[model samples]
Target: MTWTFEEMDRMFHPRVVAVVGDKKDRDYMWLRSVSTLKGKVYSVQVNPEEAANIVAMGFPNYSSLLDIPEPVDYVIVAVPRHVAPRVLEDAIRKGVNGVMFFTAGFAETGEPEGIRLQQVLTDMARKARMKIVGPNCMGLFNPRWGLRHSPEQYYDDGGPVGFISQSGTHATFFSLVGYQHGVKISKSASMGNGIILHADDYLDYLGQDPQTQVIAMYLEGVPNARRLFHLMQEIGQRKPIVVWKGGQTSEGARAVQSHTASLAASTALWQAAVRQANALWADSFDETLDLVKALCFLKEPVGPRLGLVAMTGGQSVVITDAFAKAGLQVPLLTPRSYQELATFYSTIGGSYRNPMDMTPTSRNLDMVRRVLDILARDDNIDAICYEFNMGFSAREGMVERLVDLLGEFREAYPRPFLCVLSAVHREAEAVGVRQALAQRGVPAYPSFQRAGNAFRKVWDYYRERRERGATRPAPAPAGPVRPG
Candidate 1:
């Protein structure tokens, strides 16, 4: 069944969130989750030492979940397994909608008794009509509603990406990339083990979520493969679903099982499943983030042909080879277009090929604008890949010009235009350049090859959708089209 707005809303924005835990966990949950949460937040701690400090962080600290004088709509449990069952018991008794278990040691322990205990807990919750998020999970983070994974980790300006991961570290890292890449997290859930709510549950909620335009998942294994596949296909028809299936290799599969108590699927089988569901797949954690950033910032390209404008002849040759290697075409420039760009080229060097090179002497915002404009008007190319060395550009103070030039070029050509900002020895300098480009709606990569590879994935996704006769949405009025 699909998640209704009301149910999901209550799940994320519980009116009274009871933070159920003790000792070190009490501080961790309060500092991490409760610090940024909305509604009436109360800590249900067993720390008698600090019991008198009821107004710690401006929230009352109670002895137990039942002791919290108000009606608790949700419970965030971080207690031990022995103590955790009682918290769930009290939450059900309190008529709470859900209990998010921050504690581990149930089925993932691989013990018969531990497995039996989880089953009993699920049965108890089911009888009370209560929902459980995880036996070993970090729970949800909805920034729009003031929920967060951790106050120190989550960004306040959450954007359109809603991520659901089987790993907490993956979810945390994914959320942080937005700060550097300009992608944002509308909502996310680090669903460890996924004992109760499951990956499919979060997918169902995000599918109907208005704030979420792109659904990204980092999964170790599938609980119900058939159900997950059909659900992804149904939702993927409307929105882009990027899945990064972890543990494709046998060694990695063993690690994944140990990590999340999940048996990983084979690489070939999982890949076929993802493709059949019409969802995009990423081979690594970094690639998953890159794909999400590309989807969030880029306008759909109508064709696969690329226009590469480079700083030097060597860089141009490298970019051309990179795009070609990535299965994207770097077509020869049209005679008319080549003639127009050749006007800005110096007498020393340049090329009229697909990856046209411009002399350093001619590198400026005005010339870059003209070159980009010439390429944009060409029917031979559908997207532009502008490659530049930012660290070296600082010599001519062209770095400032390139920054402003990215905005102007993007405004003029509202199609998919990517920037390849080469990283020099200085890591901080590269970060500044990347952030600047991200602000202008351009997805930047460390190398031209990486940028081209990401763009190729975007093209292939739309191309596959077209072959299947599915609807592919665009940022503008024109949707994804092929070269007829």
Candidate 2:
């Protein structure tokens, strides 16, 4: 069934929810899930006396939606698949709008009985005009509400980065890494066994969500390719959507089918889908996560005008080649700008050009400042990429000083700035330097190649979008494909 923004908003942002499943003795576990839900938690299981412990722990648990005196908006079903159908039917009968099915043994199990059972539930919900999230899903996490939907043990209402992953492990990994990188998430959902709800359903909902500024998707396959593309096209024009399509090979496709009962559409079809939608496609998990983090934090940069600021001449040369390999252009600094930078480095001694190398003498704050000030004023450049090294010198607060200088430069003239710090010294020192750079709106990568690759992804996406006009209609809906 298709969904609009208004429905999801009212359903997710509910005042009270009923968690229907085996009641956990762990106080407030259901309440904790409800607490994380961005609304009041109410338990609707078999037992009432045990549910009070959840309310005492700050989450209201109820026995049933019908039994509860107050109106219930959402239901979380964590029972077995066989029983899930009954629970769902009960919720629908009670007039609940949304249901998060955390049960397994659906279509993914390759059992006809399970598939038919799921179909029965889906048919019932559609007939009743109610929205169902997943039959074999991990559930939803709203960081803002501290609603931790998964059993993986993550809590917090994250920032504006909305993540939708087909795999629960990937979702958990995303949460862990995002927290580590200081990238807060607004909403995260691990949608398993998409019986009725598809990825596009979530994307469309987020399109209208004020809290979801960027969309990051991890998909094994899409059920409604046309709808997914349309949603992606709509979302991409406004906010960046980064996608990592798994199941590239035949074996992998089978695995994805087993994992989520997805169609595992061909790689060629996915490539066309992404290109037509004007969405950014990442090859690996690292690339996918990096693109998402970068897009979420850094400003969208136009064109490939990349300026490299290097702490050493040798590293500068290395980065210049890396940039070329990554399809990045190093526009030569305008002669006027070069001379201005020259004047700043005349005492320290270094040539001025793109990949602007400040020699050993110019390694101090004043030299870095002069070069940054000159580049900041130039309109030819669109992004600034810099490299730093952590060694004996940085322990003397060299990294801190540079971070402050860069921060000041960003404040004075805002643009997409990146830092690639060489981890030649201790990991702690490298982390300190990376964190410092990140604190100023600059994304820090460990290697020049990584920085270059990320810049390439950004630049390639920009160019592709420009060439294709980025508003093409989505491909037509596709029927199920046979296994090869």
Candidate 3:
């Protein structure tokens, strides 16, 4: 059953959503998850006890989807496997836009009954041309519309990333953890089993979504490799798509079969195909979010040459090595840059070479600004990375000033400016500082490795973009900007 983009759009942004089979025994989990939805919500339960409890929780209860007074745009099915077909039938009869089968005893279980039940549901939905998200998955999350699969997801705020994951756990946690690091979601889906709607379906939908600037995927496998790769090649030319393939190893491949009933492809082939399609590849959850964050905040394709700044001498060496290991260059500054630095640089406790180390003089905002200014003007420097101790910055009452300075440089200079906050014992302080910088449209990371690696991915993405002749500067960082 091929669904049109407009039909899928309605499913994502529903005006009225219904939760089927939410019972008191499970604490009405599905009901609670969607209770915060901005649109009207109703509960469909045959059990009188559960229906009464749902009503007590302040939601209308219906014995069947047909019993609902108004048209239902979306339905969340949480009934047992045997009852899933009945719910889908009712949903099709009601002519709803879509249904998410939260019930999990589908083909992934590898049981004869599970397989048969899944086929039955699939056939019925396909025959009716009704879109089903998953037979063994968590559903969708649209923060802008207050639609969510977990109660913990943030609403009333949205960003440029649209994430698609085969694992419900990854989908839920990605949004939760991403919020901590300033990577918010415009929409996300956890499509387990994907019996009716496949990963490529969601990818194509997100590609056309104007709200999403960067699309990230956590996939074990896709049903149609050719279609997926073809779509990636086309969509990636416009918006960046970062893919993190799961089940890469032999053991993981076997696990993927039971997890989502997906047929894992060869790792080598997957990686090569991803690059050929002009999409970025990530190894882990952290790398995916880091790449997304970098893509979200950095606006242009940067050169591999980076100008490094560190609070201490030792850090300068460590930062350089980290970036160098990540395939980035930390070459010496141009002759004119070094000459300009020598005029005011204090050689007493610092060296003004590539990674300028301000031993005890970093506290002077004027000198710090001057050094950054010189790097910004240096033709050889394509980007700048500054490292500081978050604990000291907060204690010295310099967090706001430093953020303002970086923000100013970010705006005044076209080169990418990044910040690395040393949060060894100061993780709590780093969080606040990161948020402050993010509010000002500056990206900050907790470690040199992550800062370097993420920036490299961003650089690679834009460099490829430029190589393909799509040379327009990336759209201004897609999230909120601090008010002047």
The candidate that achieves the highest lDDT relative to the unseen native structure: 3
Give the clash total for candidate 3. 0
lDDT of each prediction vs. the true structure?
0.76, 0.72, 0.86
316, model 1: CA deviation in Å? 2.1
Question: Stretches of candidate 2 above 4 Å error?
Answer: 22-30, 36-38, 45-63, 150-158, 331-363, 377-381, 390-401, 423-439, 467-484
lDDT tens digits, residues 1-484, model 1?
3346677668887778877663453455444555666678887766675554545556688777778787887787877787777888888877787788878888888888777777778788777767788778778877766666565555345667889999888887777665566667778998887766778888888888877888899999977888898889999887889999888888989888777789887889988999898889998877888888788778876888999887788888889899999988988878898687567566467775777786564456677777788889898999998876765576665776787788668867968988887766666777666767777777788777778888999888887888888776534111111100
- What is the Cα-based lDDT of residue 234 in candidate 2? 75
Question: What's the C-alpha lDDT at position 437 in model 3?
Answer: 76
Query: Candidate 3: minimum summed lDDT over ten consecutive residues — where?
Result: 475-484
RMSD in angstroms, candidate 1?
A: 4.7
lDDT of 2 by residue, 1-484 (tens): 7777788777657777778763554433445555555456666656566655555565545556677676778787877677877787778778887888877888898999988988888888888888877777766767555566644444543466788888877876777666544455667778887666678888888777877777788999887888889888877887778889989999999999888888888998898888777788888878876776576545556767788877667888998899778887888877789677655465344556777776664457776777777887787888888676665244466767777887677656667777777777477666555545655656677678877888778767766766766642221111111110
Clashing pairs in 1: none
TM-score of each: 0.92, 0.84, 0.96
Range of the 10 consecutive residues with the lowest summed lDDT in candidate 2 = 475-484
The Cα error of candidate 2 at residue 258, in Å, is 0.8
